[model samples]
Target: MDAAPSTSSRVQFRRRNVASRARWVEEAGAGEVVESKGKLWLTTGVTRGSKLCYNVEEIGFLVEKGALILLNDKDEMIGIEAIYEKIAVGKYGCSWDAFQAYKHLKSLGYIVG
Candidate 1:
């Protein structure tokens, strides 16, 4: 977290799919895998929290927008700025806007991914 103003246009955020309030609280292991809607989701171990197991582009979208804050192996919240750099190089994933949309829909009781 460098001291950049919150409104900076350089924030670099974009989402490629539907999002959810579900924080990817931790990187999942093969042990946490679960299946729903014919898609695999992992029990993130956040008191029943679940995150769809997936890829980099989408993850970058989330991190850049401040929607999904991924925790490192050490359990530290990753900053959007660092993610933005990686995204530029074509790595990482998740949708920040999708998370926002997921939260919005969840308030209405819709199960979103």
Candidate 2:
């Protein structure tokens, strides 16, 4: 019989439980500005989801792919690809609008990742 894999060689993933009121940092191109609640929010290229809400914020760095990098307001990198469709549509206008925004940003030579 084949021997089982050794526990020492196994990879472990620790799930982080975000607090209810936790804030996220979103990373976007240096000049990109995201608006919310009449205030200017930076696009960290990161989005996050919760049982009751979704949050978007600014990020100081960039990530690969179109994945949004989420961070806390303190500038600490936290999560990625956390933005969901429903929340994105609601917050960033509609699906079509969001797509347009993505394209516009990309055309400006800013990395969307």
Candidate 3:
């Protein structure tokens, strides 16, 4: 019989779980962000779906990608042009992104809130 391959040093992956944002980014590059068990999970080596993050929409716009859309927890594509416009005009205000930013930074191993 043929000899079996040795595999005792490889780390196993935990599905529906995220290691960290910095780890996710380093491993995923630009993978979709998923919220599982109240934590962000990325497709490290598995297939999932796409949900755009609007915080970097400016870069997308600058890159000539046109209007950017975001998705909710349900993974539905939704427009946000009006919201950006409102933000630009100070018609609407928000701190939701701030919270996510902090969470992301923290997940990325930063000393942020």
Candidate 4:
């Protein structure tokens, strides 16, 4: 498998707060270019209108994989630690543990939904 890229190669995204959910919107280049390079959407998120939106877990997974560089509304960069804080932790929630499990399974060649 191809290892995640370094910080320099990460794709940039701006966090977009929509109602109760926070969506990460790709901030650089065309969506097609990013999709071709990252196989984006195939792994996470959906295209809404002209923007590519990613769920919280998808943001965490992409960032952890060194495939994303998330930005705040102010255009400041966000780190993985900060991103982790946003992931909810509770029974029946999209918790960090679940994300870890998802990542592990994907690493093992499992096709996670």
Residue pairs clashing, model 3? none
What lDDT score belongs to each candidate, Candidate 1 first? 0.40, 0.34, 0.32, 0.55
Candidate 4 clashes between residue pairs 3 or more apart in a chain or in different chains: none
| Residue-by-residue lDDT tens digits, candidate 4, 17-85 | 211123234352111113323355576665667756665666676666666656665556677786677
Best-to-worst order by lDDT is 4, 1, 2, 3
- Candidates 3 and 4 compared: the better one by TM-score is 4
Which candidate's lDDT is highest?
4
Per-model TM-score versus the true fold: 0.34, 0.25, 0.22, 0.57
Give the per-residue lDDT of model 1 (tens digit) for 1-113: 68877663534333424222222333342112122222213412222344354343444443454444455545455565654454455323335454445435544545444
Task: Please give the lDDT score at residue 29 for candidate 1.
Answer: 21
Model 2 / residue 9 / CA error / Å: 35
Candidate 3 lDDT over residue span 1-113, tens digit each: 99999865222344323222111221322224333232222212234354432232221221122212234335554344533442344322224464345435544555531
Worst 10 residues of 3 by lDDT: 59-68
Candidate 4 ranges beyond 4 A from true positions: 1-37, 88-93
CA displacement after TM-score superposition, residue 6 of candidate 3 (Å): 65
| Candidate number with the higher lDDT (1 or 3) | 1
